[model samples]
Target: MTDPTPPRPGSRAGRKASGAARRRTASTGARIREEGAPRVRLPRRLAPRKSPTQDRARETVEAILEAAVDLFSSRGYARTSTNHIARRAGVSVGSLYQYFPNKDAVLTALLARHLAAVESAIHACIPPLRDPAVPLRDGIRRLLELLREVHEADPRLSRAIEQQVGQMPVVPEGLAGYKRDHVATLAEILSTRPDVRPGNHALMAVLLAAVTETVSVVLVHAAPARFGRDEMLDEAVEALCRFVERPPGRLS
Candidate 1:
């Protein structure tokens, strides 16, 4: 009878099988490590290729941005392509690429421009808010009005840009800084106000900023016909004032 035993380790068949098993083990180990490892997402290149230095270059960039805004607002960002933006701008695709790296970069530029204008308006309005003569509710109402005006100036564009930002993995440059400045400024102003109840001024400022922004966005983009802007604004002002101006030891 034949030997009822497998090949020895030194034999050719045994060595071949051993090598195949080793390779399988290695492949499985590698797959496990790959599966267990966290994925690293590189930041997107949202910045423009370069700033426009000449009037002609500036005009070309502006045209591309304007075209992108129109397309993004009308067709939506998912439907709008770089080629469409170039054609609408009446510039070559190459020219558009010379300034903006992609449509996202173009949108970033537009958002930055819009934010800068809004920041300027907010800064201008802050002085009035800081005045002792300005009632707390009145000051809050004015800030809300300013936000409404800026958002209403171009509601479609504002909504489109905001929706895209919500989907983005990263905030555009300058946006975080703007928020920090906004919160810091508001906190400082709140701390100085005699009527504002003493607590965490920074936290109050953050809440106020959030409420105003949310109300303004909703009113501009998605408010129902029954919810008039003025009525909503009044309600918001009353609610915020109650929160920030409640007397000490008052639970309500």
Candidate 2:
């Protein structure tokens, strides 16, 4: 019999078989991840998986957050005791305390959750906008639209924030990085014009977020008939755009 020899690398059957093998490997890996199975070492494909216990932990955390929104937003953080949150969540006070130290801690977590959701919406809305005159305008409009939607969807919480502006929860840990990066992005958008370096962009970004937030809070309180959401958004975006475009030494 002739010696069995390896097929050439370019053989069609070999290529087909290789492709089929890769598909099978990917399917198996996806299944393993879904089932939370222990990772199997393989040169072709490997991935980390979230185990069963991880799912339960996630549920518990989310339940606490929901309870928090109800308690803090409805009753205010100071009045919403740990026991109240526990009962609302259908979990033991001990369990509730395990995730949070005090009412402040719970509020902190809630703020983080709220900030994360807002950031996600902003991420979807702002990006790759190039024009200095119109980019900020469009970006601010999108941001305010998202804010109005979020605020209207939960008007009670929004009112709570409005009524207790001074007591608004302190910005959470690790949030500074997000705020910083976000500011940098805004600055970059504003800096496309002459005489502005990328290095100075961050300051502009910070100013943008701060000014927009202040304007948004004001807009939420004004009469809807006159300064309706869209009108308010337009005014705010226009003001911001003009501020960014102001000629040097034009402002007193």
Candidate 3:
């Protein structure tokens, strides 16, 4: 009778088949990586096709951006398309193209708008932080609260923009300036505060800012059900306060 068994692992045929399978797997992985890599878009390609000068044009652009935010937030960046955005916006694909060159360009515009709002809110908080009456911890708390509010404005959209930041050019080109400004401003304010330890104010500002942002983003998205917002905020405030108030300790 003919053998009904498949090739055994120890057999030469099995080894050959395994080797071919490994090669195919490797080729597939390479192709997937290539396809998944972020595309380097040229500046012109990312820029809007035209500025919205008229009231009607501006309204159309706003509608498109709003639609993009809704779609990108609900469906995610990968699933959302330019056609979808235009349709949701109640505009023609050609109209959206007139304002945004492509989907990435729409994303860039949304990122810009969101960043501008955040930057404004941050700047507004800086004046209060500089107030002589405001305690260091209190000022920090106020700033953190403001950041949380801004982030909460459109949490889903904010998360979506953050997720797609790597694929867009605006982050490095536009966001860098805003970040530098915030860092410099915070450093300056920290230097003036009498309670702050007399070390590297710039580094301190960076740490404080980073911690606040990280904590806020985490709490907004991945926070546990048991942990309330006020509880998390209090913990963050205490942690940041201790870092700035306490002197440097030796590493064990």
Candidate 4:
């Protein structure tokens, strides 16, 4: 058989293919720049798209939110004002009102953004629950690892969400319930283990959250010099495993 002719680069057909590939690459890069470049990487609102006029209106709405987080997290919510958020964000009061109805709405959105961030971080790292040992220390470690990863990734946001914002009144509190829900899940997993009983899940949940948050506070934030976060997280997971696996008679 005759040898195949060598393919010619820069030929008409080759150039057309190369040009198409270059366009695809450029368009993909642009999409990535837009999608990947998030402000604070927070989730956007679910509201419908605005008309061109409304789009100009949205700049002020964004400013209001940005200012609300800064002021509310810095000054007390009671001290911050809609007018203040407007001025600080560099938009007019009327412009701010175009999106947000009141200060509470602003606070709620910010808190939601915070929660959405932490939760998204957690969800992204969580693998599928397929293994039988998932209810055991293996599963517990996954959660602890996830918790630590989130805390270590954004220690400030963690502190702000768990403690600072929880204390604020401008936003209606969902945090207590949020913690309780996590506790409940932990309790459920603990209950499935041989040593832990179904009755103790509630208590275990409290313990789990307490240990995780305490370690996060002390090791990661309060006294970084004295303790290590990775060490604390590993130890906390071990302690929780003991709580679920240790027999009732082995109680200290």
By TM-score, how accurate is candidate 3? 0.73
Report every candidate's CA lDDT.
0.72, 0.56, 0.72, 0.54
lDDT of 4 by residue, 132-218 (tens): 445556665675566556566556545655565655553333533555655566556556555554555677678766876675455
Candidate 2 deviation (Cα RMSD): 18.7
lDDT of 2 by residue, 8-124 (tens): 232212222323531112222222232211122311111112222344444455566566677668778677677766656545567666556555565555544455565766677
C-alpha root-mean-square deviation, each candidate: 22.0, 18.7, 17.2, 15.5
Q: Worst ten-residue run, lDDT, model 1?
A: 29-38
Clashing pairs in 4: none
The candidate, 3 or 4, that scores higher on TM-score is: 3
Q: Write the per-residue lDDT of candidate 1 for residues 53-161, one digit (tens) a residue.
A: 6555665676677777777898899887788777676566898989877767787777776676567668777988899788877877787778878888888998898
Ten residues in sequence with the least summed lDDT for candidate 4 = 29-38
| lDDT of model 3 at position 26 | 22
Q: Which residue pairs collide, candidate 3?
A: none
How many clashes would you count in candidate 3? Answer: 0
* Residue 53, model 3: Cα distance from true site in angstroms: 4.5
> Candidate 3: which stretches are off by over 4 Å?
1-44, 53-55, 169-172, 246-252
TM-scores of all predicted structures: 0.72, 0.60, 0.73, 0.59
Could you give the candidate ranking by TM-score, starting with the highest? 3, 1, 2, 4
